[model samples]
Target: MKKLFFAAFTLLLSLCSFSQNYQLISGDQIKVSKYSSDLDIVASDKTGNYFAEQRWSWNLRAKLYKFDKNYNDIYEKDYRKELRGSIFRGFYPIDEELVMFSTEYTRKEKTFTLYARKINKTTGEIKQDAKEIGTFPLEDKRDDFEVKFAPVSNGKKLLFAANVSNKDRVSLVTAVLDPQLKREATATIDFRFTPKQFSIQDVFYTANEKIVVLGKESEETQVGKRKKKRWVFKQYILHIYTKAGKKEKEIPITADQRFAISGKLIEHTDGTLALAGFYATDPKKKDLSGFFLSKIDTDKNELLLTSYKEINASMIGQNYTEDADDDNDDDSKKSKKEEKKKDDDDEEEEIPNDYVLKSVLINPADNSMVITAEISQLYVYQTQNRSGNMTTYTTVYSYTTKDILLIGLNAEGKVKWVNSIPKKQQEKYENPNITRSEEDYFSGKTAHPYFSSFAALINKDKLIILMNDHQSNNVNPEYGHKVKRVYNFKKKSNFYGISVDLVTGTMKRKMIYDNSSDGIMMPRSAYINGSTILIPATRVKMFGKNELKMSQLTIK
Candidate 1:
């Protein structure tokens, strides 16, 4: 009888081990830079076979690494050494062996040029000489210039657009280039608006081989014919242009005055337009109070503006962790204090509204769209003295991410449900207010090491949120469900995932893999291609040198 019991116990343990969400694929490891921000993973044409990564150094020096189907590094090289003072715009994959990149250079005085180069995928070498396609004349140091490249005509043609601004005038120059970098058609649009009033959000390719530009332009209206000099916010504007850059139709989306649209817009597979952002209820307060989702039917020229969801305590995963505080003695006093404060004031817990909208993804399986947002804020620190006084003032920036809000919208642009994956990530900024060093002129340390680190994988019936293990046993779970004690092979932990049901809004948190025995995974570097998820990690050994590794997880 005792032998039978031992055998049953071993069987149960084996069953639990095999039932994990992700299985690690070993033996595919390489060397990489310690800084995760420098790595950019590009999904290749071969669905789940191979991919490419571009790493940039502190001085904007770039190196491309190509990996094979088994996650083995095959080749790496540095291209375009002559164009040192250029900014990489985008990469276009023409075929399996050929890729092209666009860069904007502002080297000469009062001159800006856009260059395109074709790259060999196998060897990471430039296929042809870098060609200067277009140039823009700058106006002093205050002039703003930007160039973007997009693949139109079903990835057969490339469309390049440049936004040049001087004083109160902004000109948009667009050119369609073929695979040989030859410009087929070019046109320019000039418009005038208040300084900082007009901004181009995104340019996308339409199904009919035309281009659509999503923009936001603020307009001012007089109150009671008194001309109070107040600039009121208007609606979002859409400009549809033909292949030759001729303006075909101008569609205006009349939005609520309380809300603001983000620069990220989605042109869906079915000819519908959607935008995800925030709205403010209080006019005086410039902060966002809720999530705003707008769906536009371009065929009928109808806009839907009734899909706004408010951020509440329940949406931030506060309800689940609240009950666990009662059982733990160490947290009892803190929980009591919070309850006392709540009772003292007959008011509800104020949910924070400083979340910045990140991405709006569409799921054609169910005609549902998911909105992902994170809490982001900036702080400025300055040291000032009056009359020979030596004093220092430290202002810590809130680059920390408190929680990520996820909202689901159904086919009719109605709110399906809302959920939040709670997390706390904090770090200091190198400068006054810059969070990401890659965005600033000077490459410095990141504000929060894990600010925007979590990855959300959206599916038809569920969504998975994956990140590095930060909570472990430190976070309390709901009282009823027994939280499993996680064990790491080494001192450090591996990756964890929170799976949420799309329809019921139910969430289950579990450790995907305890890979501490091998390497420390950078969850922020995780990428999804079809049903496969790839994560890069750092492997430290007891002797010898450390190496960079990647984990491939296949979803069944």
Candidate 2:
């Protein structure tokens, strides 16, 4: 009895030590508004105050709620009266103020105006009326105008890029705004490429106060010899411009004799830039063979370092070996040739495709970087039903997010370690002939991509990857093990966090919270503030009601 008691005590001590590494603080469950279909915690302040947005189902207006540091409700404000007819963009939390951006299109003036409204963080009240910051003229009322806003300088400034076309000429108007939503500098850039030839992939406001525009240009060019040539080619170009809109430099990203796809640009704190992405040898095929990382010195117009690593079978835990037959007999040779063909086929199947760069993390202390990419694909199924001369067609769309790849690189752009976490999450959407309710259609309750993907939080020593998975996966010894697929994440799912050592590429998977007892977590909506990771959890009750809570995970 004494031996058994001592063993039980040891087990309990170990459990306590494991639990101390992570503290899960569950906020009190608050009753969601009946009229609101979706509730999401959008922003948080340094003082631990949480701000949530409750979106109405019937209209475009939204309500904002503020909770104290302890998760107690403080105040709620409905912006329907003030923001009527305006399209909501997003929330930008600056120091003590929360700025909301909206766009209004004036038919008479044929202009689209960007407006900003500030709300007091503590009082949860609108500080002033909407202020128009910038306006762009359109050729017609139906002309396409898109505005993309990104917070730079740690949410102290905003970068706005407007893709406007007039008279078949496309131009990008870039602007920088201060914390008060005041324009500091603006510039219009005309790349001289036709609207169909060039497309803007992303805009970055660098630490050096310069604007970097990443664009993709597509052209039809023959690749192979005269008879086997193809005409489909794509290249990515980077345009560096001063804050005042003056064009500084243009850099074209390319790999020798390879097609660069899904390229991403990372600007380090020291003003150096890195271009990283996957590459495919054959443009006609969708499979990727390797990834390349290139560091550039923009000021000197020189490539500092370039490294390429192939996706071999060993990297993904697959084995490929060519069979050899030493016998001089013709039958042995034939058998060897057949075995070699089979091995080649197996190796080709091991290569993964449909991967997009998800996130890039650079250590400020040493500039060591980590790149993450995920496999995303969409499959559609169509079915026909015929009943008594009436035929109906049904379409189902299956979206899958799987296999996250993590590559760690040293300060000199050399890859140190590579690992992949295998997970399969699928969300399906079916088109119905009958009309659905606004709450059911817009709430994303039935089919939402937010719960299908994963989120990552990185520190100096470890990288924590969060995702929803099947409950059975919690018992797996480590990541990359064969696991069941997660379907209908909102109804049944388990939240997991896989912590990876930055140097060794070792991983430890832990079940953070189970959705069965807690609430369904939206991994994409998770935000990290300092060492604490905040995620919003929601449980749908009967009659379209939602029970909302906040999950705060503090890394000890």
Best by lDDT: 2
Clashing pairs in 1: none
Cα displacement (Å) at residue 543, model 2? 2.2
Candidate 2 matches the true fold with a TM-score of: 0.80
Residue range with the least summed lDDT across 10 consecutive positions in model 1: 1-10
lDDT of 2 by residue, 1-556 (tens): 0111111001111243323255677666666654443445667865545555645444446677776666666777777777787766656665456788777778888888888899877776788989888888877546336667776776677777887756566678878888777788788887778666777777777776677777777665454335333333377777888777788888777657666766777777765677888877776435677888887665664444379888764455432221232131122343335435544543322123557788888876687888998876655456567999999977755566777889998887788898887776766555521122211211112224546788787755788887898676675333435556666565457887777887888787777776887578877777787568877777767586566676677766
Q: After superposition, how far is residue 116 of candidate 2 from its true place, in Å?
A: 0.4
In candidate 2, where is summed lDDT lowest over 10 consecutive residues? 1-10
The residue ranges of model 2 lying beyond 4 angstroms of the native Cα positions read 1-20, 32-40, 54-59, 140-144, 220-233, 283-286, 301-305, 313-352, 379-397, 429-448, 475-481, 490-492
